[model samples]
Target: MFFHQDASFEQLSIHRVGNKAQDEFYVLSEQPVPFADDEVLPGLLMQYFMSPFAKVNEVYRFMHPNEDLELNEVYHFTKKFFDGKMDFHSLSEQLAKHLYEVSSHPKIKGGELYVVHLKNVQMEGDSQEAIGIFKSENKETYLKVYPEQGGFQLDYEPEAININKLDKGCIIIKNEEEEGYQVLVVDQTNKSQEAIYWKDEFLKIKIRNDEFNQTGNYLKVVKNFVNEKLEESFEMEKADKIDLLNRSMNYFKEKETFDQEEFEEEVLGNPQAISLFKDYKSNFEDDFDAKFEASFDIADKAVKKMESAYKTVLKLDKNFHIYIHGKREYLEKGYDEEKGRNYYKLYFENES
Candidate 1:
């Protein structure tokens, strides 16, 4: 899931559909859906609204055309509409009706969709669009996300702070099988396009509870930990830190999985530094209340995502990227006796 808190939702408007910009639709369960904990729904619901693209409500089936598509196939399958068999208005109506039916669905009881106008809905200078959201209820799931990033913002969201912006949003609480009350669960959140396929093709992808997703909140903690340790121990120059992060990201690109030993050897070659990293990692997990995998593997598509956050550039009015690919022998950082000045030198094809 995107976050860890099992929080509650307010401003419940049952079957309350807002305008296209702010529509809240819910499908309630006729039966109570039982859950072990309530730590799931907040993250799940928030992640849903975090999507960049608006998911077409439901899968459409063509009648009269006799074109056979699976039921509950929700996506931008507008080709059929282009064929003159169904028009856009018809398609919209069809999906809307299907959502309404789902709002009052009987077989699975009830489910909900919240079209939220995300107040302060920002990703801090990220070009995150084409987002997909998926949720599962009673074995049914679909990708749900808002399909647009109108503008980007660069503010960090605070924790333990209550953000009540439901004036332009909604949430779906599915009461399945409980027959009374049900606890909700926050399942997953991803910012990497590497995992976009899961949202696009198989809307009902089952998440493995065992293997941790590298793109989850834990990875963010790990990144922070890495940054802090590097800053504290190496006291690295900003350029050096960025270079290390870029190199680490390159390692993830070259090798999908991350082994601590390998990371230490490749990214932080100094023995004592690696030891410091170990301590930082230990404290990080404890302090952040997050964990990492034995071998953290990221989808290759996510490599591009790491590029922005892990870029290594020295700004001198323009920009210069310092790419360090092994061979510390080619680099120099020391004071020159003759010049009595601090200096840093890098050797590469451009210089050679």
Candidate 2:
């Protein structure tokens, strides 16, 4: 998990980035924003920038297709700033300019870009300094109510930023500079073409092949194989599919490490099914550009996160929803010729 409980802002620089496609321009601040005197603003700004990253587990690194890390613009500037070769204000300005160049997307909205130098961010067991890059593209109107002359007064603030909603954010940890740093990012508006520019075009980052990623990706491969590929090669009922999913989840939950051969033999007992699953897993790895090790420690967090997706509900013709947890042998599927309908025979001792 990522935490910033003891984190404090070291430097903050705000710049106005405009939509370049609309012929708008950007404005850079002359100096960093000072918050030493104000006590409350710092906490609010910190929440705005850091709160969204509290539960981010997946990590990414700056990557280039040709294996040249220096080619990544964000990585270059951040590395220089971390090495003390460049000042915070200068680095923020350069980053703002780079963002403006990529803001050419027509759907990209102009907003205030905030560059923050944060200290004492804790991730897992290690504490490290991190750089926070945030942008506020959307604004809201808030009504202010105050007492005036013993009477209630109301005023409207036309341009107000809601601290709770952060539009886009990226946290670049100082650790692992040689491996492109441990970067955690958030893009709340990542539903459109414009959102792609923030992480893909601007950051140029790729998923780090850590334990968390390995576990999550492998689980996804198994799920996809069960749901999609399994049907192509075999005739199976929805209940049977759910049983396979339940078995897969149970294997991950009970075991500390994953062994491909052992998993195939136990969870997928059929030799033909195991062979098909291996081919599908290989294609999945190739499509995602990820390699799943033959054996690795299973990440509990990844398993828990993926548990919700591996639901065991079997929906039957919008009428009955059977939740099959385990014991596929106990649940039998058959046809009732007399009633001219299909039915299920569930053998359960307890009604409750």
Best by lDDT: 2
lDDT of 1 by residue, 1-352 (tens): 2211222332112232212222444333222223225688645555444332222121111211122323323322223343346543344334334444333212221223322112222122222111112232222223334435885445343222122211122111222112211111222333444323223322322222122334443334446656676666556765566566666666776875667777779877889877776777677667643455657665554455445665445543344445554555666778899998666687778743
Give residue 109's lDDT in candidate 2 (0 to 100): 94
- Assess every candidate by TM-score: 0.39, 0.97
Top-TM-score structure, candidate number: 2
Candidate 2 — worst ten consecutive residues by lDDT sum?
283-292
Question: In candidate 1, how many clashes are counted?
Answer: 35
> Which stretches of candidate 1 lie above 4 Å from their native place?
1-212, 215-223, 316-329, 333-344, 350-352
Evaluate all candidate structures by whole-model CA lDDT and list the values in order. 0.40, 0.92
lDDT at 145 for candidate 2? 99
* Model 1 residue 331 CA deviation in Å: 3.8
